[model samples]
Target: MFNEAVTQGDDPGAAAAAHAHGILPSADFCEVVLEEPKADSHGDLSTNMAMQMAKTQRMAPRKIAEALIAHLDDKTGMIAQTEIAGPGFINFFIKPAAWHPVLTAIHDQDGDYGRCDLGKGMRIQIEFVSSNPTGPLHVGHGRGAAVGDSTANILKFCGYDVQKEYYINDSGRQIQTLGLSVYLRGRELIGKTVDFPETCYQGAYIRDLAAELLARDGQELFEKDEAAAIMPCARYAAEKITRGMRADLVDFGVTFDCWFSEQSLYDAGKVAADIRYFREKGLIYENDNALWFKTSDFGDEKDRVVVRQNGQTTYFASDITYHKDKFERGFQKVIDVWGADHHGYIPRMRAAVEACGYRREQFDVLLVQLVNLLRAGQPVAMSTRAGEFVTLADVVKEVGRDAARFIFLTRHYDSPLDFDLELAKQKTNDNPVYYVQYVHARIASIYRKAEANGMDLGGFSTDDLTALSTPEDVALIKALARYPEAVALAGAAMEPHRITYYLMTLAAAFHTYYNRHRVLCEDDLRLTRARLHLITAVQKVIRNGLALLGVSAPDAM
Candidate 1:
């Protein structure tokens, strides 16, 4: 819970200066950071502030550490003892009584224990899973959705005004191809032989859409010209597929605050207006009968084509306009969750944001790598073009939403993941979600047992924690104390996987403590009451963490 002890009331730098007046620099020279020791034998918290100031003081680190310790003030009696470890590191062993505040804070705060004010209500927009509406969302898009949604949740918990968005790519060549795919399938159903090009979508859903169109409007659709028929087919298919996508995402525990359409940019003439604004500022120029953006001026490798010589705008042009609109809407930060294949697009997009008069730091992109779904360690092949890929909905139906989301976030977004179908569906310790959820359920079972024994679950106070003096009790308390730090760090790094890692670690700690300690001691009613309160805090923290990841923490397995 205490990241920097020196900065909190106890100023080690000032103490050192007071000990050796004018010999060392002021406390502002370097930040004194205290870290929790990995091994309990080392100490509760350790710092290397003495070594950090050794060069300026011209003194050995251990000697400086000893001097600082001798002059340090412990008015609150939080620290039980201090030791100089290897290479002049000062380790402080916190008093057992000091940890009682953490348990009390956990109980007092409950669901809001880990929430922090890191963002201070900054407006942030996270756009993710903006997949083309030509097909169903595959597992890869599912990963993006999990990452983006969890990141937004983490940021929101950190006091940011977060907005989740889904950018619809409803207007493009992909839409045209979707329309053609459905139109060709419609002609075939009407006994007219039509050649389906490879460029068109080949999914069975296209055929379904074709059949639905015929049933809705009859064979009269075949009377329209091919050019005129494509738009109607495209519009219908896009609308249907987009609706299905929304349903899939909602079922997967993801709901967007906004659904932005790419076609709206063109409809409002924003793209042309943005290009004109850039041209006026000399950022856009006509070269070889094409308009080029000078992205190279803003750290891009070279200029990019915004408009082709054929007088048609490229996707880049629309992207520029979309980002411009985002900034104009007054979001302090914009985060785009994209597939790994779009990794190279970051530079140009950052350049565009900078050209729009915003700092590059304001724009962030999370590139989610591919997920290779497996069944009992064997790879399941997938190809969207061939229409052979497994849909996200299928996976959710096979292994529930909680399992799917927990597995998706087990790895960092930049790393590839192998989601085993059999493993995810298992109820044993091998499944990460089950392992974590079991902690919550196990604690709930303890409460039920307490109720059966007529043990009072209420009237918990700091005095009840007096029985919590064992090493295992301290370790669990320490783990519970780190939840706020974990949430704040995950938000600061924009990595939701960090929360998953923290959850696993905390769950393991709880399991270890539960196995070794008897929470319900018939001989000692005080100890039983104390242990119940401790585990209750653990359950609350676990439930809070799972909520951030969009996963459920069940009271029963």
Candidate 2:
């Protein structure tokens, strides 16, 4: 794309580049902006510094651009040409050979090529998929799992001290309900006619737990009293369901660094301590026999009750104290990925964090929208059976872990996604995961086929990269070079789905190039080596992209 143009300081990219040219625009030109052009024909990179310097220099914008271009060198053989275009925009065209070193960088870095020191190793804790330990993880939880897990992987890739955590709601009324659900089910199995309350959990898993409870403890559980037995039953059911949740996450390729227990906060009296600290700050007040947190003054919609008249602490109160504990553990940043339904809750949580003396930006809640699972372009009814909803385990079992993870990341976390289970199951190009993974498999096939024919590529070397002159070859190489930029952008924006789309583009370019030309050149050894080296870089980048999404890059379909 270079017509042969001759081409940092903390001060903006345009100013730094201008300083390199020795023709400083006006002293007043303090700010500068640089961006990659939308169209390659415009140039590889563009800057509008001329417009920025116009009023200060009192010169025509185009004249300033021309003067700047006149002093600019060919960026040490990287920039082949520079031109002044629309409204004094300076565009620089980079030579093909300059891009060649990106391939070399990929070769040297390999797995670590797309990584950067963006986070600079700051401690970040991401708590997600903390579904109550009352039922199996349903499809709704699956979306948050994918978003959170992939996000953690990305932050880690970007050089952050990242920890993935799952919070277990092992306290409060829910745990009691789980125990009651299991207890009533146990009575039914023991031939005791008991009316199950409508408020109890209706999942079939609870019945299974109840049957196990009855088999183990028998009438002795009821011999003393239901009150005496309910506590143990609650603990048992919570443990069982939590175990199943962990298993499901493991199956889905998600493993948390910690399983935080809500009960632990209460056990250690952390909530009471946090409340007392707030009271000392004169932020907590007793009203109508309940302890109240004046969150309204801190930007919340209204004041919230931290403790009820009966002395039971609210979930909000415990969560506030839990966040305080998170910061005390030395996490520089705390990110909680919650459901979109909690959008209104963000204000209250932020207010609480601020009232606790932490900056508002220190705590962030990533609200993940709902996912609608579809089959053959129609909605799959996700109603319950035996009190259990259609679970995430069912979806993962049908389409596979890789497909489930990849498809779930095809859109941003905030956007609604209609997951087509049928499309995800397909082996065709319509299935994006299969399409991208196939590129890796195809490259592997090229090497295997070449080696089988006694046309070994030997070791990859780029001494004869000049053989790569075709448009398809150049496009594929260019696409390969964009992997790091894509990764940086995606990680910086916290949009992991962007990486999936980037891989698809790379795969398509590689596929197009492969169909047009051949890699194994029997007559030309240099051409063969060059193509092999290029395709090897392509394979590495594809693998890198796939790895970021927590999906596998298979060598064979």
Q: Each candidate: how many clashes?
A: 0, 11
Candidate 2 lDDT, 234-345, residue by residue in tens: 9998998889999999999999999999999999999999889888988999999999999998999999999999999999989998888899899999999999999998
Estimate, for each residue in 1-557, the C-alpha lDDT of model 1 and write its tens digit.
Answer: 22222231334455455444423333333466999888899999999988997776555777667666765677788998899998799999998778988988998898899899999999999999999999999998999999999999999999999999999998877888888899999999999989888888888999999999999999878667899899999999999999999999999999999999999999999999999999999999998999999999999999999999999899999999999899899999999999999989999999999999999999999999999989999999878768889999999999999999999999999999999999999999999999999999999998888889887656766797889989999999999989999999999999999999999999999999988999999788888889988999999999999999999999999
Candidate 2 lDDT score relative to the true structure: 0.85
> What C-alpha lDDT does candidate 1 achieve relative to the native structure?
0.90
Clashing residue pairs in candidate 1, if any?
A: none
- The local distance difference test score of each candidate is 0.90, 0.85
Model 2, C-alpha of 248: deviation from truth (Å): 1.0
**Estimated TM-score per prediction?**
0.94, 0.92
